[model samples]
Target: MNHLISRAGLGILVAVAVVAGAWARSGSGSVTAQAVLTGLLLGGVYALVAMGLTLIFGVLDIVNFAHGAFMTLGMYATALLATGAGLNPYLSLLVSVPLLFGLGYAVQRHLVSRTMGGSLAAQLLLTLGIAMLLENALLLAFSGDTRTVAVSFDTPLRVLGAVADLSRVLAFAGAMGLAGAVWLLLTRTRLGTAIRAVAANPEGASLVGLDVRRLHALTFAAGTACAGAAGTLVTPLVTVEPTAGELFNIIGFVVVVLGGLGSVPGAVAGGLIVGLTEQLGGIYLPGQSPLLAVFAVFVLVLLWRPQGLFGRPA
Candidate 1:
């Protein structure tokens, strides 16, 4: 009951911030509308990115820092297919998704699984090392060059008197659909039930004959796959560089923290809030980095609800 109230309160607070920001920037209704729409679209991608991080943490309790790198890898893979083989970027998902899934599985099974129940410091170092290795490998392959995937439908669309790229709109729809699928998977599937059981009590789950290690690998793989899909989705919207994922990594962490550490719904809500705060911040502070607004909101939320809006009181 208290959790419900906390969630509602946080929602109200974030909504107020949005309203206040919008009102403050009310000089041009069209610009405000544009920002709001763009922010919501961008937030969908953010939510998808954070969802994977939150899922890994929720089920395996592993802070996988390499998640964004996995995302970058996906972008590169999609780009490669698009540029080299004349394949549609969206169709590359068939390859990128499985590629990331296999890589994530190997990472967890061969490296991360060995560190389970061990030192958190060691786990952090391991994931950090993995991130560095992946980034450097990408640098070697892609050579620090900025790349983009070309799509046939790279045009503009109007919504509510505001103009947005077709790619952004499609990305937004795809992201929301994927997020909903994930939500259903967690709520209405046997695999999800088993995964949740493992999350609740790994030892007890093991005692009950569930293969915890396998589930951990599966969870990590699913998480990375989510990152990969998000990367592919945004390939048209952003430039692809070896270090591109670093910015996303930072944002993912902020979203994960701003949301609950292990809550999927929280991550989604946080992503949208961050996105809105960033876009609106551009209007409120003309010359400042939009992230400044994100941090401000994050700090305010943490100060008010340390465990995050959806996180259980610890």
Candidate 2:
């Protein structure tokens, strides 16, 4: 079995356990366990969010500020289809993934491409506009009502006396599988080589007559598709409201920045770090809960390894 934590990762895990053991000694063992599990699983969700954001920033040299908007689009679409059209929750991936990929591709080709090589201010402003448009569009279509996607309205699963919704388990599994696949693609394929080439040296790739523009479109589309898939997975657990992507957007960017700009593994590890920080910190500290720990870790990470845990030095 793959180890749950790495040696370096284990050190932090141990520190968390020590503090949580204090809580458990006070009759909070079960709560601590639940928090650990929650952190591990929520890490998977954050992994999904960061996978794409890092990819775009890594490959295209564009910070996609609107990634969360595409994520919101996925969540809303899944909610609409699973609840309104009566589609099976799992099967909705058949539609949501492709539909959003196409949208991402078109947006990149027309809007993002136009702003390529421009000032960072221009790119940020444009994507921010797109994010605003998507959120408002969702508000208009759904009337700001909360919606959700789930298999059965009231069936929660019991595992070893811990109660969790089945959909959440499925979401965690789906996110892991997807992240593994993306890691493989980046490490094991020719297209992956081309992507790394561009990320490493865009001008050199252009000298070889590579279709840099097309690759950018593909990379952006793929990143947004990752976000869409994550949304489809998590819509079941969270409320699918217009602003659903807000928190996720903030954290996802933090993860990418923490993980390093272009390193896939950094993104994944950074996500797990965020997940554990939120859960363990919430339990031990209780008052400030997730944020105090999350930002603390973020700053520590940047201070210790400014290039990110796995990101290459720029």
Candidate 3:
């Protein structure tokens, strides 16, 4: 794992150097700076999404195909509160987070928990069904129209000669702050200790008098809450559509695999790397979609480190 992380780190540095060199040769230092800045900010959002995902997988050992659906639900929840109730989008987190958390907990306790210790295929199908159902339900309710929350701080901020949207900066800061808080919860709190214990050894946790099922439900709910927070944060930056969660779903998976299947900090690192790859790719591959570049990096990383950059080697 250490060696893999080192190699990954080296690859990131090399990637940065190459992108910087390309931009320099093109005499577009400002454009390069802007891409890097944009990528980092975008990466913060990705980290927030992926952190929830990693946490769920780490504890529940289930790949939540419906995770993105939860995010879309969050987006709509925030949108409804902001537009209907005249609440600030950021302030909507209070409602969105708890609502999603309760939904997640109920889903896990009533539905997902049944599939535990069963076939992996069963879990996949269940989550995929949930994803489809939630998405279609959203479409029925809101139609395909794109909704957005307008914010006052849409102005651009200058950072080191590069321009960034103020909203994006705020979202980035919020993402980092939330991620840090989650990290602290995991490392410091008793519930966190129980969650970690369950992740490490469910039988052992059970033997230690831990209510494993409750912890699983709580962890899953916590993960969904993170998704809700992310949805709220990005409400001002992106269009809110039923299908809006699809892109985040794809990126979240990429981040999960790249960072390691179950590492929280790894998700953050992977998100930044993916973000950089996206922005730099736009500069280097002028005609291709930036996501294409992200996939290329994903492929290379998978080839070299299937356990992920931060995952323990088997």
Candidate 4:
């Protein structure tokens, strides 16, 4: 009961802050619209990445530090297909998604499965090591050169009085669709029900004839596949390099926490909030780093609800 009240209080506070901020910047209507649109598009991608992280954490209780690395691999895969075979960047998704899914399933089955029920430190270290290995391997193979997929359709279009590239629009649309699909899979499918059962209580799930270990692997694979798809989605918007996923790693964690670990809807809302905060912060602060606002909001939310906005009280 107290948790509910506290959450409501925080929500009200946040709402007030947003209204106040908007009122303060009411004069810059066009600029505000541009920021809102841009933030929303960027937030969609962030939500895609966070959805995977949240799923793994919610179900397997694994803090997958290597998620961004998986995304990096996806970016490289898409770029390679585009540059080498002259495939359209979007067409590369058919290959990259499955490739990532297989890689994730293999890694979970052979590697990550060993550390189940172990120390949190062990899991973190193992995932961190995985991240490092993938990054270094990519560095060796690609020599740290930034790569891009050539696309001729990236023409700028006016959207609600704000200009945006076609690629960004498409990326945003694709991400939202994928995120929704994941949501439906979780809420409507047998696999999702089994996964949720395991997440709720592994021992009970096992007693009920469910294969917990297999479910864990499946969840992890799904999570990694999300990272990979996100990477492919953003290939046209960002540079592909060995360390490209590093920043996203940070942002993913932030979004995961902001949305409440394990809550899909929370992740989506948090992504939009973080995205808007970043864009509007630039406009309001003028010279400060946009991330400063994101962190500020993060800290405030943590202070108010450490379990995250959508997370239940411990």
Q: Compare the candidates by TM-score and give the number of the best one.
A: 3
lDDT (0-100) at residue 44 of candidate 1?
85
lDDT (tens digit, per residue) of candidate 2 on 245-284: 8788888977987888877887888888788778888875
lDDT of 4 at 1: 75
Model 2 bad stretches (over 4 Å): 1-27, 153-161
lDDT of 2 at 292: 78
Per-residue CA lDDT of candidate 3, range 154-194, in tens?
A: 89899988999888999999999999999999999999999
Per lDDT, what order, best first?
3, 4, 1, 2
State the weakest 10-residue window (summed lDDT) of model 2.
1-10
Ranking by TM-score: 3, 1, 4, 2
Q: How big is the positional error of residue 269 in model 1, measured in Å on the Cα after superposition?
A: 1.1
Candidate 2 vs candidate 4, TM-score winner = 4
Go through the candidates in order and give the clash count of each: 0, 0, 0, 0
Which window of ten consecutive residues has the lowest lDDT sum in model 4? Answer: 15-24
Regions more than 4 Å wrong, model 1: 1-17
lDDT of 4: 0.89
| Per-model TM against the reference | 0.95, 0.91, 0.96, 0.93
For candidate 2, the TM-score is 0.91
Any idea what lDDT model 3 has? Answer: 0.90
lDDT of 1 by residue, 176-261 (tens): 88888888998899888888999999999999999999999999999999999999999988899988787777788778888888
